[model samples]
Target: MGHRFPAIVVLGWVLAAAALSLLVTPLGTVVERSSTAFLPEDSPTLQGLRVMDTAFGSGDTQSYVFVVITDDDGLGDGERRVYADLVSTLEDEPERVSEVQDYLGQPQARRSMTSKDGQATYLVVGLRSAVGSPASDEDVKWLRSAVEDLDAPPGTEVHVTGDPAMISDLTTAVNEASLKITAVSLFLLVGILWLVYRRVTTVLVSLVTIGVALLCTRGALAWAGEQGLALSTYTDAFVVAITLGAGTDYCVFLISRFREEYGNGLEPLDAVAEAVSRGGVRCSV
Candidate 1:
């Protein structure tokens, strides 16, 4: 749309962008970073997993988290008490927890699970959800916070780490990194455009066009996701990059040509319309 159409069109776009941004958050609910089914069908990992499933139930069905309690001096009554309390709290949730293997009153388990110098002890927590699933991630996060909240005696350190913890932390890092990249990219885009065009109006117009396009695309993706469109967590980040790249290219072409047309004696609206027609045809090719 040209400056003529934009008398109302841009306002419509701005309003639509504001409204559609709300739908974008829900799209995050469908975006998943966890799923252990990423392996190739004939891979050795898959083969081992199949064997495990046959022998001792599906490894894919249960997630595990490790609670390691460490001390430089060695295990003590304080450490054992902390482990016992955590086990009791975790066992309260039957729906979320499948088993909590505390090394209490079991000589064999304690011997095998403890470090050689007796400096560290650990508990194996089995969760009902599959590995890398959302429920499993939540359970791991909850366990981590719960263990940290315990009043362990001095010199005892509790840590939660394992397959589920790794997945949860990785996904969290990806999301935070995506947001940082997007913000930095936008800020740099504005600075670079201002340096090139040297016109405030020009810079704003181009970004507004790109922003409107991005918001519209996000709204469409969210709708498609609700209709069963499968997308990765990286989809949002990819969309931002693609939209900025393509949108900025098109905007540059149109604005530069519009300035040329205006200098050649065309009216403002006529120049924009001509720029759009010319830019659209060439960009498509």
Candidate 2:
């Protein structure tokens, strides 16, 4: 009965895809992208954070600083003012900032803070204990803006970079790169499918089937994660690549076999059944 209706088969797939998309779209809310996701749950860093949180009523906060250089002359008058202003700005935000250390003018600390060329020195800003431990995106944005707002002399420059900055930058980079990679992969898939099939209808059908496979795989993974599975953040990209590559290959194989069967004088529906029986066995193996 189903073999007599190929349009019905395609429509069934279309309807299934529509339903799966509804379920997967909302799963985006539960998707997590944190350091804890990448690290072992029993790792020392996680253990240390828990212990610190218990003992201190919150987790430990990190202090970040910049090694500012005014000119080639080394920690001079302008550079010293830049250092002082940085300290003052941080101190003013006592809620977010716990301490500010300026070793620029200190007699004993001056040598350590200054570079060999005497153009650079470090200004440390201690983040408050109750502040975001692994600073949130908003926190990082605020920190950057505050540092950029500081007035500096002609040769002076301020740099706010450390572990927090690096982590924030890494997260941003991963997101952007994943999107570009996915787009490029899809574009290439369509081009390759067209080259292999030649017929526009065949290529379109192949793409539709690949899309359905990806949606179903992502939806299943999202459901598993919701049910307490520890799915990694990288799983999405991995799933997309695997499903599309394998799905397109299978589609091409089956379509080619159907065409061969029809060319050998089988009826349209008979050709489909023959192709499925043959290709399905190969896929199952």
Candidate 3:
């Protein structure tokens, strides 16, 4: 199609990419970052989670995180206020935090959450959103920021971790790595391609093809996810690496084939048709 009506094909792909980024379900939305997400859908834990989400709502599900506060001197009255205040603060954000376990009044629960050294305690925070969902990740980030801003006694330190925190942190890391990997891959591919081709047009063509493939793969995955498929958060980073490597390799082969055909006195369009038709299976392999 590109060889026949290049302008129309280019315009169509441009529109497709724009629509993919703007209109489609975001790539992150369908990616699951939790360990449970890696479990089989029929796993007892996952089944229970689905049942809980369906019956009691995701807010009341078993999706929870811990906020641990510690001090070398132990949790004194001053530190108690910090914990109380932190719970109250999280409680206020109903949209982010669904349930906050307070050990302030429950002596039994307090003992359970308290460290043997009496210097640390943790809160079991039930998220208002499903695990690995965007809503849940946002909730963890907000909770972390809130913990950091709390006024605590000297030698006191606070941290957020556990199931929910793992999902949130891993998701954020995957996203950051995807962007970094893509940028670095582009830089390296451009340098290497330019060195190999020594032609600006050929270099740009290779990159353009790669960019289109990247957009299409992301779009296709998001689309499949909407149809009840889910992928790991790390898939994006892996996809970026494979797409660039394979896409560039395929382009190199096609260009080489075209040069070979055109050198034999074939016309430009004929050369492209010959390259594509003959290179199809081999380019993919």
C-alpha lDDT score of every prediction, in listed order: 0.76, 0.66, 0.78
Using lDDT as the measure, name the better of candidate 1 and candidate 2. Answer: 1
* Candidate 3 lDDT for residue 274: 83
Model 3 weakest 10-residue run by lDDT: 32-41
Q: Candidate 3, overall lDDT?
A: 0.78
Per-model TM against the reference: 0.77, 0.67, 0.77
lDDT at residue 26 of model 2 (Cα atoms): 37
lDDT of 1 by residue, 2-70 (tens): 354656766787788877787455556555533232233577765775676557753443556899999
Question: What ranges in model 3 sit over 4 Å off?
Answer: 1-42, 48-59, 93-96, 215-239, 281-285
RMSD versus native structure for model 3: 4.7
Q: Model 2 over residues 1-285: C-alpha lDDT tens digits?
A: 447677886788777777777855433444552212334547787567557645753243433434354565455676677677777777687667655656645668777767777777776555543112234434556777886877777766777765555555776676678778889988998898888877888888788789888877777777776777665545666677788779877887888899999999998888878888887553211
lDDT of 3 by residue, 1-285 (tens): 667786887799878887887787777656642212434557797678768766765435547788999999878988889999998898787766667777876778988889899999988787756566656666778888898899988899999997778977877887888788888988989998898899999999898888988898888777777777757656667877899999988898889999999999998987877898887553221
- Candidate with best lDDT: 3
Error of 3 at 244 (Å): 2.4
